[model samples]
Target: MHEVFTSAMLAASVAAAPAQLSSIDELAGTWTLVAADLIKTDGSVVRDYGNAPKGLLVIDSGGRYSLQIFKAERVHFASADKGAGTDAEFRSAVLGSSTHCGQMRLDGGQLHFHIEGASFPNWEGTVQKRNFEFTGEQLRYLVPARSDGTVPVSVWRRLAGQAARP
Candidate 1:
């Protein structure tokens, strides 16, 4: 009876071990732009937004993603410079363009994000995704460049349990 109990306990522990491991489900949700620091190849940090740049990242269980980034200062410029142009026009010209697309899973932990009509031509290529880590309420993922040349790395954080609109 003692041996049987010990075996059952061991089996239960083993079964629960996989659950402890992190999975992509942890990343499924909407993420607000907490902070984005673009690191240049020369190790220079460019703080374009000065603390808060409006941005959002949405990850779905069906393997889809959409991202938007904007600058608060641009709204003022757009209104002044665009000549009655809508806020969208000002945002596009100033903060750059937003990216939308579906992601394909390369493996259990890696994903290939194909940007749909990315504003930046260089980013239009396939993005290799990896290195996912979660701390507290934040989930981060790394996007490496497909080419050997310099590429920007993106770090994303969860958006307080809000569902991704797109």
Candidate 2:
């Protein structure tokens, strides 16, 4: 489900906006997940996504954003019903997917995500701060280390349109 920021909400946020991101106007478009990696504190890497990860991140002019990421290859549950998945299926679904939507603020080198909702209940109503960098068409960020002592870094590339371009 996509939640949109109405005109009033957008006006209110812009009224007190201290962190202006005019420099990152190039990021006002749809971006597709290009790469994702989790680095453990032990200096090991977990690559459960094989070679491809599927996801989308959309950023609008109002600072509202939505992100969804998932493993490209997930096993199907035995039951076709959405709520009747087996334990293993449920586990896989939870472990291999993430979804969050809310407003975001970019201040200098720091990025803040004011999460309105998330697939991980613990993250709902929380603010996540991260260091971010944008190079060419790719936007990258280093998330704060997780409770498991792993840091997940994600890269997103702008999705080009079919028409016009060199």
Candidate 3:
């Protein structure tokens, strides 16, 4: 009877304990892109950045971060001059990459990016909130739904030996 009571008490105490909290400091490091996908409302997945995307994300302990993602299969501009690209080439170039830098903070299990500037000029000076989770070395985040109702999701793996310096 005593053993039974002790076991019951232990289970009750464990049930009353809160889940372990996650800290923003755990995100401070250099991460490489694993995948960039878009999820449709009907449950179909689209690889918007091609089958193998390329990207980098760097987060500092000081709350600053820079993120860049690019399509690995972008078409090369035929012209040697950077400013001499055709309209289609320019559009392809713009559509193939995204980059932004800003201050980031975690609140209520969400990450808020206060954009100082971005390749997409409309995002400059705006705050974007993302729902994110960490699994082992990978960090995954869901982008808010767009007007078309597709949600973008990005997965990044923390680079080994790239911990943030004090």
Candidate 4:
């Protein structure tokens, strides 16, 4: 179940929460996507990547962000050109990837992802809300539901210095 932050809860949290988290700067850094699991209603977890998923969530000082998450065993396009991949290859690539670019906002630890565009066209121009948690160098968020009615909980780790493009 999701935690709802009431006024009293917000007040209590603000007292102990660091000031940086009150602003976007708290999220301004390179964060490696550690997990994205589809939580089935049955309580079983379905993961996109068989092993550790490959992903990157980068936030600039301006609060603008870009994210790319992919499965580990993706096959390279035999055609070598992005647009020229075979039909099966295209299906595998598309189904195994999630990408988006936009801006981020936080309200009492809740994160709002303002999508300018996304690989999944349905999400383009949409604003999705998620509950966020910060623990040490980790940031976690829960996306209510994906198209399949499965919840996706994303975990990210704060990376020191510039990380390779994901």
Please tell me which predicted candidate would have the highest TM-score against the true structure.
Answer: 3
lDDT sort, best first: 3, 4, 2, 1
Candidate 4, backbone clash total = 0
Over 38-112, each residue of candidate 1 has an lDDT whose tens digit, in order, gives: 434554544434445677877776667777766544534434645787867755565553455556344554445
Candidate lDDT scores, in order, read 0.51, 0.69, 0.75, 0.72
Q: Following a full C-alpha superposition, what root-mean-square deviation does model 4 have from the true structure? A: 7.4
Task: Give the alpha carbon lDDT tens digit for every residue of 1-166 in model 3.
Answer: 0011222332333234332226567788889998777777765667868878899998887679999999878888999998999898888889999899999888766778899989999999999987766654766677778899887777788898765332
90-125 per-residue lDDT for model 4 (tens digits): 888888889999998876556788999899998999
Give the deviation of candidate 1 from the true structure as CA RMSD: 13.1
Runs of candidate 3 exceeding 4 Å displacement: 1-21, 163-166
Q: In model 4, what are the clashing residue pairs, if there are any? A: none
- Deviation of model 1 at 56, angstroms: 1.2
- Evaluate model 3: give its TM-score: 0.83
Best by lDDT: 3
Query: How would the candidate models be sorted by TM-score, starting from the highest?
Result: 3, 4, 2, 1
- Model 3: residue 105 alpha-carbon error in angstroms: 0.4
True lDDT of residue 118, candidate 3: 94
Error of 3 at 107 (Å): 0.8
lDDT of 2 by residue, 1-166 (tens): 1123333332333333343234444456788887666666655545534458788998876668999989867778989897999888988888889899998887655678899999999999999986665654666666677787777767678787721111
Native-referenced Cα lDDT, model 1: 0.51
Output the lDDT of residue 126, model 3: 95
